[model samples]
Target: MIAIFGSGETSPAMTSVHQELIARVSDPQLNAVLLDTPFGFQENADEIATRTIAYFREHVGCEIRLASYRHGGRATALEFEQFLSRLGNANYVFAGPGSPTYALRHWHDGAVRERLRAKLRQGGCVAFASAAAIGLGAYALPVYEIYKVGADPSWTEGLDLLGEVGVRCAVIPHYDNREGGTHDTRFCYMGEPRLRLLESMLPEDVLILGVDEYTACIIDFEAQSVTVRGRGGVTVRRRGTDRRWQRTTFALSELSHPQVAPAAVPDSASGRPEPDGTDGSPMVEQAREWGAHGRDALDRRDVDGVVAAILETENVLNAWAADLVGTDERDRVRAEMRNLVVRLGDLVRGGGREGVREYVAPLIDVLLSLRGEARREQRFKDADRLRAILAQCGVEVQDTPSGTAWSLQSQN
Candidate 1:
């Protein structure tokens, strides 16, 4: 199975898909590895590897090994063999966030591609997010080349990993990108106009698999079904017509049979309906309501309520992530989700602080009582020691006529 993430590799939005991929591995402790090929060109490539390792360990509850293939030819012969060994042994391999062309240059017709193919044959999961996802298609869009470097809008020869599964298509990540707020950069910074021109260059049999940002399409070979999990759906463009499926299950047969027209229902993205009678716009509206409920809970400082509300929204989002169309609507829902998460974090921290204070108050009272007894018994040394210990803890103990009052300096 290949899990292709649109974007947001290490972000909260991708948490669900990451976990899903991890779950696909039946191993009690998954031998997860990250390929540094994509970001290998960056000066801070090592830093990216380190951060991703920590993220998997801390967030995903799995330790990830780094499969460093920084350069195609720079490494020693022994080092190259070791890199291949590590990649071969990994049960779950992930590559994300960098230059597609650069990564492809190293992966194409190389040991990297062979090892990946072998791993898949052995039932290992290959998860590609963002740049890595873009490189697995029949045609690789040189995004930086054209968008940033001003090269002509063109399609480069991709790794074409999808060809193994009998699907001839170009994988376009960030399908619903809105980064260029003023202009149209929907197709990973290549606006629809340029994207159309690029599509014209493709052969008739090849289709366009446009995966929206923060979205993922998991292709399950065994089940022969493609599960779309993330903030957006998968867009299949055949001969200039796009058929998008979100938050819904579809057969793998749909990929090969491009002529099977989608049901006529107004889609939220383009206001065009699919051949299948299902429309996912209602799911989006439900998610929005949950987001509003979460915000309400946050406003009232209802910690449990906030958590419940957010979890409810997540349930809806995950259940309908494929159904979510309309870049604007998806963005709004995602923004609300992020805000909810942020505010929920704040609430948890605040509540934890108060909980700690409350918990310590009784312990402090017991200690004070023991110290009072010691003082009354003429155990001056013990009383002084207790006062000194409290002082060391930044707690001031005042022996007043009424009683001993203790206050934590941190509270002040």
Candidate 2:
């Protein structure tokens, strides 16, 4: 099974989807792993890993070990083997939120990519969100380079996992982006003009798989089905025509057999398709500037700064929300703004939540260690008190022949 998420991998908004996917494993002690290659270049890459681990533990109730193959060149032979071992063990693997190009650079022709392919071949689940999702196709958009750094629009050879599974397409996440509150920043920030140019660059048979932020398109090979889930829809674009699938199930076989309706090519004399009213919006442009600032604050771990930036963007959206509610472009911008706020909020909350998980897990470990010591010393009263205290706090301690294992009891 392949799960491609547009964004919000660890956010509360994605809780149901995560839970559903995790449930498919059918193993209470499933070996789940997180691939940190996507966010490997971030200054706080460790933070990203910790938060992702905590998200699985706290939100999904699945303890996910980190498969830290960030850079193969830096790894010892033993470390390389260990990383592969983890991937081999993992029944459910997840990667999210980083530079697609950077991840591609490290993952290119490596054991990590091969291991991922093997996992999918064996019917193990592969969940990719945001940048990782973008890297799963036949071609990846150089989102940051083209959008932020002002480079020419272009596509890079992706990991092509989908192609291996029979989907000849490029995955574009954050399809309904509105960070460019004034200009068109949709289509993973490429917008229509640049996206069309990039699309023209692709092989004619290759399709565009556009996943809106907060949405997912799950490709299940076993069932031969493609199901769209979440706040938005999945778009299949070919030759200037787009077919959107929303909250629906369709045969995966349809993807392999392309049935795109032909459209007349844009006249070479004019050079581009006519603009679809997605031009300049001063409010949207200002919102985009604030959105960038908010992202910077998140990277710096400045919670207050993130809140301020979100509020600044919110002010612009709130002021113009009414007027932009009707048009397709404006409505998408509003939706994008909403998603931006949620993502920024998740950054601050995820940091604090991960911190709590880190603190709590070790404290519980120490308590469990002491409980073992007290039991060994035959201090029944002390051991009982420790166990009771943990139980009172919703921690279930179980003793087995191997050792003591603990789980936070489910509140529900």
Candidate 3:
């Protein structure tokens, strides 16, 4: 089985995907490993590895060891063999985020590509995202070479891992990125113009398998089918035309033959009712959903999630405002937006982001208790050290007659 994530491999969005992958393993303890070669060249490779490991252990509730094969040429013979042995032996392997060209070159130099294919053949699960995902197709897009270095769009040899399941195509992650703002940044930053040229460069039979951000295209070879899940879905590009399949499952063989593929069905026709069944506008329902997300995030004290929900709700309102239609749905959505804004205001009062305080209060209280112990023992330096650490984090501590109080410093 293979899981290709367009983005957010280790983020809150993909937590369920990781959980699904690890849960499939029969072992009580997951025999999982992270292949770190993709982003191994970074100065903070160790930090990345640590954070990724922590995310799995804490967020995903699984244990994953690292197969630290940074660069093939620089690695010792023992290190190279250990990396392969670990990857081959593990039932689940994960790799994500880096330069596609660098990963291809590293895989080619280290001969790790064959081991990956062999593992897949043996029914092991290989979940890849971003750069690692781009390298699994019949050909890879040299993302940095073309998007960063001003080189012409061209194809580089890929590991052809998708070919193992009879999907003859190139994998393009970030298929729906809008980071270009006024400009187009879709198709992994190749944009439409360069992307069109690159599409013309492909072989006649090979199509393009474009995965949108925060989406997963899971290919189950044993089942001979493919499933799409997440915020967005798969975009199949064939012969200069594009087809979108969202939250749908299709036979894996249809990818190569392009026959019997299903088109997107409307919610009403597909037995799925509108969110409220009263409003015809999808944006109104979307705003309601994002507003709910904001409330949930506020409850959990997830600062980023709350902010994202608020911004998304605002975007929905802006989009609806541009429309000429007037309805009560819009007013209801406005109420939802106003409620979210009021919640946001409550979360950032008394000159600090109280959301952070709500999230960290228990830990802060524990630390202060430790400081109190140090003070009682006359270890003034240790107590001062604790206070200084909090100060560095913009947490002002005050010792009052009642108790200790702490507040985050205002950036403004």
Return the top candidate by TM-score: 3
Candidate 3 collision pairs: none
**Candidate models: Cα lDDT each:** 0.74, 0.75, 0.77
Query: How many collisions per candidate?
Result: 12, 5, 0
Per-candidate TM-score against the hidden true structure: 0.66, 0.64, 0.68
What are the root-mean-square deviations of the candidates from the true structure over C-alphas?
12.7, 16.7, 11.8
Q: Write the per-residue lDDT of candidate 2 for residues 273-372, one digit (tens) a residue.
A: 4455433344555667777787787678665665566566656654453221225544444444445445543543454334333334654675677679
1 or 3, which is superior by TM-score? Answer: 3
Query: Which one wins by lDDT: 1 or 3?
Result: 3
How do the residues 1-412 of candidate 1 rate in per-residue lDDT, one tens digit apiece?
8888887677556776788778888476688888998889999788788878877776677788998888887878887888899999998999998899998987764677778877667778889988899888878988899999999988888877788777888999888765554566677887766776888889998888988777789887777888888768888887668788787777888865655454232333553222333212345566778877878877887766665665666566554443213466565654565566566545544553345444345545655765787799998886786676556545579988997898765532
TM-score attained by model 1: 0.66
Per-residue lDDT of model 3, residues 8-82, tens digit only: 677666788888867876355568999888888988678778878888887788889998888989999999889
Name the regions of candidate 3 deviating beyond 4 angstroms.
27-29, 259-412
TM-score winner between 2 and 3, please give it: 3
Residue 371 lDDT (model 1): 72
